[model samples]
Target: MNSTKIPALSENTNLRYANFIALYFAEGLHMGMLFVGIPAWLAMQGKTPTEIGAFAVACSLPWTFKFVAAPLMDRYAYLPMGRKRPWVIGAQLGLTASFVALAFVPEPLQNLDILNIAAFVASFCGALQDAATDGMAVDVLEDHQQARANGFMGGARMIGSSLALAIGSWILNVHGFTAAILAISAMIGLMTFVPILLREQPEEKILPWTAGNASIQNQTLQVTNWSIILKSLYSLFRLRDSMLVAALMFVSMGSYNYFETLLPLFAVKITGWTNTLYSQAFATADLIGGIAGLLIGGYLIERFGKKRMIGIYFFLIMVITSTLILSKTLWENSTFLYGFIITYRWLNAFAKIGVYAIAMQCCSKKVSASQFTFYMTLGSLGSMAGATLIGPMKENFSWDLTFFLFVVLLAFAWLIMYVINIQKLTTQITNFEEVEPADKMNSLLPNF
Candidate 1:
């Protein structure tokens, strides 16, 4: 790698960061529609909780399995246009098409299969785009910038998801399902243009379309292959710390996924609130409190240290989850419910961003997408497990009991965090920083 290839801490760095944010934001919009807007829509049509859970599974399974294709994303690139950018462009187009198709599906409630199918397809594209963007961020950002970048990335996601939820619900309420889907499609189309404009780090090969670039156009290098990817994965998982991190990632959030799945339905059942009200309240919390958390998360991690900050925030989340037992009464009091959500969402955002920052630290830029996607896959598994369990729990037991279970599961995650010694992992990352990227990647995962 040439020194000149790396962008300095200047306008170029800022531009790349901005592009990363936009990419994540677009992905989040797709998530909001699937998680919040669609669930609410399904409920409005009198779908059962189990049916809604199935749809959530449909949307999430792609993300959980996305790691299977992560290496392909790392190995192949259109060197002419840009490495990751080309993948982003293609995925965004697919996402747009999926939403547009969803828009035309008639009588969405009666066409449940079509809706779920579209959501699953959109999710797959979003996951691919997300992997590409993560690769780009890993390739470009410096070690010092990792935490802050994750913060901004997380912030952008929450803001986009929240805004889409609010707007999608309003559009659904006003102009019906077709309009809502069309609006989502249009928003995605506009956001897709953000990555198309970014300049990928200078490659030896130039675009074939350029008249004078014929000499560089035919040059190709095959850097990523199955042998390399398999070697890397083996190395990543062989470490005890990596194993610990996987456990932490899986159990860290407790029942957050389940809670999220249930919240909209709970609001409607308890308060007779419509989708608009439910979407607005949750979106407002995520947009306001979530942004605040992301803005401060990096600073807080630096100040208090990642371990201490995570412990504190996780404890705060436990306290907040316990409060959900009172949500029935709180739902009856809109003011109190909003206050609870704002405070809880803020703490949740803070803790989750910290986890992501730590995950970013674990990857070597050499195989950033594959390594990071592995961790994200762990997270998705945890979420899927939680969501799958929640439906049965809610059906058999009371909501209060379910809340109690969430608290218990979170405590298990906290226990793992206590045992992991985060300071040691931080030291490992810092040590890797001092080595060459090639050596570091090798040390993390050596060939057998």
Candidate 2:
């Protein structure tokens, strides 16, 4: 290694790193649009609260089942583009097609089923893309680069979502739903170029098949199928103190979804807010919250530790929910109502980021992708349960009661975290040493 060649080599490495970050960011942006833009667009179509809730559930289903297909990326190879790139490209094409189809649905309000089916297709592709992108990020980046990659990935998602909401709102206002869908479709198509331009690292090769190793290879192959996916998913419960952690993730996500699902309805019912006002407030909260969360989450993960930060944030969210409920009682007071809405929304956004970051930190690298996906899936379960319960709660109970119920849920989340000794779990994961290969190999082939 020539001394003079070192700096030039470093520069080349830097360029490659930058390109990977750019590709990750591009993927994030495309995914964010599907997450935020499409939902808001649907809400604008005059969908009822329950219908909106159902749509949210439908959109999240693919994510809940992402583990089923996650192994395909790990086990297979795409000789031309690499293992992950093929999945990414295919997903992008599928997403683009779905969005384009959405553009042609006449009377979107009347064609609710068609809209949902299109959204489901888009969600499915997005889920696959997310899994491939996650695996690629892990495979391509060294340990040192993981943090930076995640930060850029998070930031890009926020930026994409902000742009999507901003653009979708304007298009909905001026050109209507069809035009908005077409414009979004075009954006999705443009994002496909990202995977096309990016290069994938070579796949990691497991050992070749042999009589004694046959059992191990068979097990590895089994792990690649849906049966093992489900088994691994079930293994989530086997982790020490995982129940409470799972509960916390579930309730926090549920509350967040409940608040979001009912937000437009809340605005209309309580404040008599117009569509524009509702859209602006909702979008603003999301953008601000996402940005704040991304920045502060990284900071808290560094400073206060993941466990303490989660506790503090959950407490804050509880306070916000309480205030939101109280604000409903004071709805006639415009000044108080306005202040309450802003503060409540901001806190809600802030707490959400904290909860998510904490959840991410809890997953061990051994099963990082699968565990994280499973946690997300559990959150979806929470959302589904909340959506089903909230409507009847509102009809039978009261809006204030419903909000209070959210507060209770948050409290439940906090209790679960406390009982689970979240700090211990976090410390265990943070200080974890990689399993020894000898031990790993033994475990892989115990009979041998």
Candidate 3:
């Protein structure tokens, strides 16, 4: 299709905002299906927790390491419509097809192995969709818009995930597995049309077969080779503030992951709540928390600034976590337990979008997908570290100390925020240059 006789997405304020929120909502759709809906269904079918957990791992592995494929997004994409939109559309199409394939999986309970393989394929496509969408967001969105857009997008995703879980589960019980899968497929398949319809630059083609060429912005942003991408990254890693931000990203997310991993055990085993109660209560709290973020997270960031908002949010986290440590007597109190979960969830959602804004500010267009994904990968590593230490933490340390350790990590991250100079890093990113040759590499920001 040719251009629709309209302004390009980046130039159209309302459409641009709508596009990202919708795309990210699509992200929440499949995540809800995989993580929430399917797990609950499997439990109903008498699947062991280990079996359910195995399915989760298969779906998750691709997300944890998706960064390995991130450079491809920077290195190659159909630049005619937009550098990243083609990949977004392609990934979404594959993702939809994969869901349809999942619906038709023969004898799923009897063939967990095959179902898992299909899950992995679907997740891989989801990861690509995530990467591509992030790249496009960084490229087209202005700095002022990033934080608000992220808030809205984050909320949309949480809402989508919540809706998917509720609606998909209803369909599963009433109609069947195939019906549930098709519903998920339809949700994502419909959102794919948004990117397909809009041009990133006004004169660019809507479809490659239509009569138009890559915009100059696309031409400027495209990386010519792997060497350039790697060398550019090499230079970026040398900056002191970049390192600080990366560390902050890891610690902050790691702390959240640690809390998440420990919550079930604390609630069900120690506090004597049933698993069903914990799940439903936590899900409801998380949904409310997500809406809170969507409404105020960006407004706070806009008024107070990213670093300060981060400081406030993490400080709140420390307060709550420390309370959990200090008030061991209140563990079984229903009021206290639900209160902690809701507050903590709100803080996590708030802090995350702030981090997303900071990350986008850190990226240079040349390797935005790669660079942003690297910071994300570090967070994944932090999650691994947090998850790995849990068993040992349980075996060797008291629960108070275990909670205390993550609180300490959060404190460290809070302090790191004070040390980072966003204006300086913005300068570095704005003046960022590709390494002209290997000879001048300082082992620094100027060459990136």
RMSD of each: 5.1, 7.2, 2.2
Residues forming the 10-long window of minimal summed lDDT in candidate 1: 211-220
User: Worst 10-residue stretch by lDDT in candidate 3?
Assistant: 434-443
Q: What is candidate 1's local distance difference test score?
A: 0.73
Best of the two (2, 3) by TM-score:
3
TM-score of model number 3: 0.95
lDDT of 2 by residue, 268-310 (tens): 7777888667656656655665565445544554465545665
Error of 2 at 322 (Å): 2.9
lDDT of 3 by residue, 288-353 (tens): 876886788777887788888888888888988998999989998877998898888888888888
- Candidate 2: stretches off by over 4 Å: 1-64, 74-86, 101-117, 134-155, 172-179, 189-236, 326-329, 333-335, 364-367, 396-398, 419-448
CA lDDT of every candidate: 0.73, 0.60, 0.84
TM-score of 2: 0.71
Clashing residue pairs found in predicted model 2: none
TM-score list, all predictions: 0.81, 0.71, 0.95
| Clashes per candidate (backbone, < 3 Å) | 1, 0, 1
lDDT winner, 2 or 3: 3
